[model samples]
Target: MSDANNQTKAAPKHSAMHIAVGLLARRDYSRQQIQLKLQQKQYDADEIETTLDHCQQSGYLDDARFAALLLKSHISKGHGVNKIRQSMQQKGLSRALIEQVLLDSECDWFEVAKLKAQKKYGEAVPLDHPTRAKCIRYLMGQGFDYEQANYALAVEVD
Candidate 1:
């Protein structure tokens, strides 16, 4: 019947809180990320706000925790501080919060660069100028600064 077909086609209604909890149940999400997802789902503004506040108060949504987790993941992947910071920013974390998390992490950018270089180029430093430059560029592309990249290649800069 047309009525049965229409009922079947109608989407099930879900409260913003329900949707948010469902999302968080799978993985942690930044407050802003949740807001965007709820907005995309056409949730009412007030409903979205209420849901976000409840999630935050319930310790389900935390930007800091999200940022920290992202940082740890990036570090494990051999990403430099700059790349990690950029990633957190892209995830909608506040600049202050990103800086605080990075500061608290106490990660050594130089060590990460060196390890990445070692993994990519082996233990011996590249002897040829072009090869060395390529290694430096590669490190920089991975988010290391010039100084860090040079350090990773064991190049001394005056």
Candidate 2:
């Protein structure tokens, strides 16, 4: 009797499909995030895999689409290529997919850097070489290429 009870306790308490649906209903998650969360919940690996496959087939989960959403939100908030790439990679996106998205984006990355720097500097920009250099550094830290950073810093946004 105790053995049978123990076996029942070890079994999954929730259906795989229910967990998948609950997660997706919250927000878009990368496959990796979904998998990690599912694993944490002690879902059966095979059952989870089957659920993931079904979710993909039914369009409940999509890495490519998740990548696009990440790109758009990051761009809107002024994230640079490297930052966005790293963010997506942490969520299990492939480098090739990241590169393709950046390449296809029409957003002016240089302009983005400049705008971001200008906002951070407020009004003491052109007169302050040190501040300008600091801005350059900050923008670089955001993953802008040197050329892009230079152009962004050189031109004052009026």
Number of clashes recorded per candidate: 0, 0
Q: Candidate 1's C-alpha lDDT?
A: 0.92
* Candidate with the greatest lDDT versus the true structure: 1
Tell me the deviation in Å of residue 154 in model 2: 0.6
**So what's the TM-score on candidate 1?**
0.93
C-alpha lDDT values of all predictions? 0.92, 0.83
Residue 69 accuracy (lDDT) in model 1? 92
lDDT of 1 by residue, 53-100 (tens): 999999999898899899999999999888888888888999999999
Q: When superposed on Cα atoms, how far off is each prediction in RMSD? A: 2.5, 3.1
Alpha-carbon runs more than 4 Å astray in model 1: 1-4, 155-158
Q: Kindly list the per-residue Cα lDDT of model 2 for residues 1-158, writing each as its tens digit.
A: 99999998895678878988899988998777888888898888998898899888989999888999999999887778888888999999888888888888888998888777668765445547786677778888887878877877674557
TM-score of each: 0.93, 0.85
Candidate 1 positional error at 45, Å: 1.0
Residue 62, candidate 1: how far off, in angstroms? 0.8
